[model samples]
Target: MRFLNFPFLVYENILKHLEPRELLLFSFCSLKTRTLVSRMRHTPTYTIFILDKPEKMSYGFVEKPEKEQILLSWTWKKIAMESENLDNRTRLKLKDVLLDCRVTFHRKLNIPTLVCRCEDVSSRKRFATALHSHMCEVFHVKPEMQFKLSLDYMDELPYTNTVRDVTFLQSSVNSTVADEFFEKFHVTRALFSKRCVPDRLLKHSCKFLEIKNLFVDWSPWLDITLLLKVKCENIMFSSSTSVANDAHLIMDNFNLEAWDPEVDKIEYDEPVHDYCEELLYFLYDIKKYMLRSGILRRQSDGSRALDKTGSYCSS
Candidate 1:
């Protein structure tokens, strides 16, 4: 094509003006185009967001506006029927897997997107991994992956330990599925959930844990033992019923020596109950007891105190 014949610096400037979707489409034209696109000096960092149900993967800059993003979706429905209807669609080979790729505007979002339909369920993981690796190479960015997973689709888990953040959607998951999921994936940054996540999974250390909408109607899904078992740097509980009893339990049984050293903070935001007063009291008593026993020493500020675990217990 005439566009490909342009001077190297000339076309490089032109490629910089194209949006992510356009750049990706141009890269698919030929090997030289792909190389040229990859060689661009200023490439936007992309985060891969994966959804299990209605399985699809989307890539875009998290800070950018919604319309600027590009989505690559996969669907299993009407494969035989749709393939025959579209004449412009082509098969793009990603490693060993061949994807039936077509460019179409998203129905609801109305943004240009590449829709790929894999041949079988077994090939989905391979296709996703290949696409992730290809984008990383083409964009010269490290993978920053996130997943919004449904327990119903546990069999479709992403590449293990590659995901940075994971949000578990509410689903009736069996023990077997839960075990397999925890065994396969280890969340690095955070875990967010609105369901009764398995206790075994909570034992995995993460940077943040946020649980929402789980304590409605005084559900016993969350308790002191479970809270103590969570090995996270920070824990946030929101939209829950009163956790006054749980707070009391922490005061009684919380052991600095046995507690996970990684745990630095725990936050609670309850609509029905405000336990800040109780938490303050609990921290005060713990500080007094620790000071009496020399487990904690007061600083010159007379406000902050550090425990033997090197964690600040501030009131």
Candidate 2:
């Protein structure tokens, strides 16, 4: 059909009703048709996976809350699966089909454009690194898409740069993998659950080492310097015994004097009983020291810091 021969408004109206998979096919008809499809405004809000295996290629999708249906090709050309039912693997120049999908969608769609999902076949497992490397060399994959790993691979990952966001299967990985991932990606926002923060996180001084936010089980063995380096803010942990020691460490080298009072906020899960008493005695002289140089006023340190009856500020 001569799709481009229609009136401009009519062509657009027709194109808007078509799903992304349909638009992809429309784009392949001709360069002119592809250009028209690319310029369309409405974007589909659906996720589609084009499954390809050594012998068959199939695809499927789910519109928002619907269950994703998997479809397979019985015969490539005789009884090919429709776009409404595509799922994984490697048929066609998959890299090109994927690139064209991105192009026709004008690079905006609910679905993350798949480069290669062909990890393994029914009874045959292809070399993953070789396949993925070839895809990277040929196609341009957007870094924003999440790479849902079968497991947080223990060995060194090859295409680290392409993986921006990662989701690990539960009980399938350990802190070592998470640590390695953080060290490599240096992703600004990161989360680690059910695992202890590893030593690799503390020792590295990489520019990417500035972890803006982190969530992990607190261990007393953790070095206090790591918290300072990670720039953790307002996070509460229940190590009552270590607060006094940590308070002293903070006062000595964490440069609490230079920190902006209005901006920096720190919280402890434990009460301020032992920590307050210990910190007050430690700070009494340091407060006097800061005031002696005229950096802090003596009146500011007068009774509030020295008083033992009140809450945080004594006097």
Candidate 3:
């Protein structure tokens, strides 16, 4: 029992030393330990997908001292769902610990990339609401805490139940729906604060719009261009149909250059809401000025022109 006399910080550090997977199991043994582990895991962790590596080397091989240039070891985070084995007492303890940990270590929680595949918009919205409610309650915070909740969706719409901030939704569903959803739900100015509007939108209004990235591929979106400026890192036009052929004439459409990520300070338009200064940059913007220049001439011999008018704007 004397060991229990040690400071909670000591216990926390010990748990921090455990592998992430191990922490999940270790959390079950006691109320205090579970709390410590939960606090340690709140901050978002990151993972970078690597497409190419040396054929003969494993990460361990690269780390071996024999190799002069060692590749950095990689780490990532995974979220956990409720497990039924824990009794209500243990469950309550775990939840309490997580709540306390979230507040005590607010800056440490990892922003998670939520992979949602729900086809129903209502279901997705419900999920966001549930996620928002649980986190806010667990942290004993207000709805504002939802801003800190960052997510990334793989092949899923950004709006499931509703549109929330800082969540990335990637999907093959028609871009038309995504465009409409953002117009209906997301705050354009709040988006601008994070520099969320892309240049294509800026060119539309001829004002400085901040965006990290933006995408529009259908007609209804054109209606909201006035409200949809983003200072995004990337701007994508999935289908030019959104802007009528004549409208495209007046509008400076986004190209690969639209993909370049925006780098700027955060600023919000409203008085009550808050914003986060991103501690890191994860996505890259790709700009495609040439493709938007309206010149479609190719060489007679089937080779792309070696040179054409360079980008008219700066990324």
lDDT tens per residue, model 1, 260-308: 2244342333311221333234434544644211221123222222232
Candidate 1, overall lDDT? 0.50
The lDDT for every candidate, in the order shown, is 0.50, 0.35, 0.29
lDDT of 3 by residue, 108-140 (tens): 332112222223443433333443343333322
Residue range with the least summed lDDT across 10 consecutive positions in model 2: 303-312
lDDT minimum window of 10 residues, candidate 3: 55-64
Most accurate candidate by TM-score: 1
Better of 1 and 2 by lDDT: 1
Residue 210, candidate 2: alpha-carbon lDDT: 43
Alpha-carbon TM-score of each model against the true structure: 0.64, 0.39, 0.30
The candidate that achieves the highest lDDT relative to the unseen native structure: 1
How many clashes in candidate 2? 16
**lDDT leaderboard ranking:** 1, 2, 3
TM-score of 3: 0.30
| Candidate 3 residue spans exceeding 4 A from truth | 1-10, 20-31, 38-172, 183-315
